[model samples]
Target: MRGVSADGDAGLGIDLLDAIEALKSVGCAVQAVITDGVATSIREDRRARGLPRAEWVRGIASQIALARRESPNRGGRHLGFAQALVHEMPHTLAMLRTGRLNEWRATLLVRETACLSAADRGIVDRRLCSDPAILDGVGDRGLIARAKALAVELDAAAVVARHRKAVSERRVTTRPAPDSMAYLSVLMPVEQAVCLQATLGRDADSLIATGDSCGRTRNQLMVDLLFDRGTGASVASGVPVAVNLVLSDETLLAGGHEAAQLQGLGPIPAAIARQLVADAVDNDTETSLQRVYSCPQSGALTAMESQARTFPKSLRQLIDLRDRTCRTPWCDAPIRHHDHIRLRRESGATTADNGSGLCEACNYAKEAPGWTARPVHNPGRTHLIDVRTPTG
Candidate 1:
């Protein structure tokens, strides 16, 4: 029979689907063969020639990266899977070669059996991978459950030891995000995580019941309280943690639904912004306001000017508010410097039009070889800048 056409023509729908599935099966078989070859080469080279593991892996990854146009991490993952299939899980390799098991499924077997010794892993591979029909209706979650049960049954002590080791490595990490926001990640015991979540929920409910007109949502209140407690800010003592907000007079006074920009954070309900302002003003908390004008069409700000020419503190604050985060494309790092898009020595004006925010890494990356940056003033878009790299 003639194969399906490249475009959506010249075959029945079922036939086209069958052809696609056949191609995918062939591709999996091909992958298994290639991986086996690579694994064999690595083993032979490492044993007979005595290459170090690190150097050999780097060499393999470099070759794979150049050939496949993939990152070294991806190459390393492929090699890892290859090594597992060749040495630890021959039955898995057979299933993969016969197109009965996909890469993800085989990888799952490898990952779930990681706590097992090589001999135990081989036992598991033999049991599960011997017959494809046994897993006919099993999904990823089901497979994981079945595999985990088998592993724990096989080596209960090993599972307990692995769990105890993982508990010792628990930690909290912070990652920056767009709009002056950051993510706080906690890797802890399951019970501890649940307790932390429940605590946040209880405090949020209590705060919401207090009945301020602030219109802060439950999630918002939880976040605020977490920050408040973490930073040791006292709401009762009138030393609440600072939250910056930008609001217009019309939205604040007239109760308009126009969203307000929370500094470093993105947009929030105008009502919430108004309530924050009212609470701060009523409590006599330290607050500052600036009048910012915007271009009507693009909604970008007009230049904020200063006569001192060294870039005043007010100007720095203005740039921070305008850009919110690093101006480099795809970079969400918090703004660390108020920089001239066109270099100061290159006759760039010390106005908002020429100023942008950049994090330390990106700001210095601009000074690297073959990098150029400058502001491009479109009539409607006043706060536009362009950055170029060596490649471009």
Candidate 2:
């Protein structure tokens, strides 16, 4: 054969794209049929028994199993996934039909919008996929980011409420893995998880740097510390690992209902947090309390800097207590550095208002080409740092 002709290869690729588009259209049509069938069966069953319309899709597990040939639980995800596209996100559904969006992309739209109201989701679908050509080459990451950004921009309040509900449902679980390993999952609020990881890393780093040598790598050391604590044994390094909690004075002193935030974790119930604070004060000689004042409307906290004006451990603690995590939006990494939102060379003050907590990665990323961050002043709202990316 002559060397594969580039023109012929390009033609074949175009033909494959056409075939995939046809498959996507067929998939959407088939899903429509399956959904209608499920609805028809549910309606007919309800009519025979005089059940209400609201209850029609409630007890659908058996019918779903019989029709879909899968577990009802899995079937339900598909059913709801399909229904959402058909009803709320017709623009996205149209993209699926036109082969501009694949099955997974369409599914992603449904998933990320699960927290949104039907009307808001429809708005997002119309905004993002109204013109199917716009989604031609957008990967999953871009699609998700676009969807989430739109959702938050349109209705930050709703997103906040959804997050609060999710936080309430956080839990921990475990499962077996390959090679006699196990996976331990702690599904808690973002801040809590960040704090735990940061604490472990801090202890591990300290041990690695000590005059006494530990041959184990940082990763290995972290695991050892985790296991030692889990098994009720002291960490071998003998350096105290402290986790700070930022509690409101009202909650700490008067036993109010306001939940205190654990330094690395999110909110803890007022009563239990108070008890922990009391225990710490009584037990730990090194425990020092920092008074934090927060604005009533926005809950943004501010604390006074040290008398020496030094960015010491105390100053780091203050920023951590104030920001609670990295100041970068959507990046919840624990605060590893106190950074100036305005660069020092540009006359950025070193005061609390001009300072923010940022993880090391984000801190470094801010210095990368075309990235800029500066604090904004909003009269009624808390101070915000506006970050502009290279793309922006």
Candidate 3:
């Protein structure tokens, strides 16, 4: 593998293709192991506890998540894919095992056939994957379109039902982006999403035609219009929203070069923070400042304590500021739950030191058996948590 990098371009291309095929084989082997493990565990649980299948499967995904070093949501999806390939889609699995189809393409096949019955799904899988050469030139979209068409032909009613269920799952979400920007995404029905985009474009075009766009490009004007309409703030005027900007006294008062943290987003330049504050003031927007003192050396916020079991709003905010995101290692999801590092039933006090910010899924996954989290002391000005998973 290392020598492949030193090869000529033609040789390198061949080596790369071989490497990818090898990876696909490895992925297929891993899926087989996961499927076997799940089956074995379920059988053992049923025999030992005489429990229902649903009860036996509880917390299994959490164990898989720990073993795979992924979030529980991803673990569940993996488990589902493994089951589908092992039991229902044998043709697709065979193609994957032989490296004719990669894991992602196999997953797409499964997803597109999700609305079909087992028999119907098998037919689609066989039609699409039985001859490995048939998929040689097929792209992702082409494979998905073929599988979807087959699924619809097999069971149009099931496809319509799946669409209805998917519509119910539509939601809006946000994620941090590069350069202190953030991506705001909406998952809506296709027609509604298209109409919203068309509306924004039409308005932006009208503004451009009227020469009132203040030299902004059409795309820029469309984005600005979205912001103004969403927040009820005029673009020509300052923003009226209450944005939390966490900065040091040195940065805010003495022109220090340190970056400022924006809540729900990440860090921004100190200059931009100051300009935002100045704009708010100039526009006479109502603004209030609450002092948050941190250690000069370590930059850790001062600890706050409470006797109540539930964390107070102020303490929750402090934890949010301290952690910035989910505390689970490798999971950068935004904090949706203020979790107790130590359980309250075990005498964990509602104090800043014992509090941690976590995403909702991670918080729930931690409640499974054999998962433990505790605060550990560190000499540096940073909060340290020791988490032990069942596999560990």
**Cα lDDT listed for each candidate:** 0.73, 0.72, 0.83
Alpha-carbon shift of residue 127 in model 1 (angstroms): 2.0
Give the per-residue lDDT digits (tens) of candidate 2, residues 1-392: 25533475888878776786778676865675468566566657766887666555553432343255553345556778778877788888877776677778888888888888899999999998999777778889999999999999888988899899999999865544553245678899989989999999999899888844268888888888887877565444222446577777888777689877766666667887776656656655356676767778888775445433335676677778878877765556667789888787777777666788987756765664446778786645676888775435
Provide TM-scores for the models: 0.52, 0.51, 0.92
Worst 10-residue lDDT window, candidate 1: 57-66
lDDT tens per residue, model 1, 1-392 = 38545465546666777656656655755665676586467556655766554434334532343245454345556667767777799888777766677778878888888899889888888888778887777899988888899899899999999899999999876665664456898899999999988999888888778885168898887777777787686453344556667767688889898788877667877877787787788888777676887777876766787655568997897888889888866556678888888888888789888899987756665664446888887888657777765435
Clashing pairs in 2: 191-264, 192-264, 192-265
Give the poorly placed runs of model 2, Cα more than 4 Å off.
1-25, 52-55, 59-71, 211-214, 230-392
Ranked by lDDT, top first: 3, 1, 2
Candidate 3, residue 156: lDDT:
96
What's model 3's TM-score? 0.92
Q: Which stretches of candidate 3 lie over 4 Å from their true place?
A: 35-43, 50-55
Which prediction has more favorable lDDT, 1 or 2?
A: 1
Q: Mark the 10 consecutive residues where model 2 has the least summed lDDT.
A: 58-67
Local lDDT at 388 for model 1: 65
Look at candidate 3 and tell me the lDDT of residue 207. Answer: 99
lDDT of 3: 0.83
Estimate candidate 1's alpha-carbon lDDT, on a 0 to 1 scale: 0.73
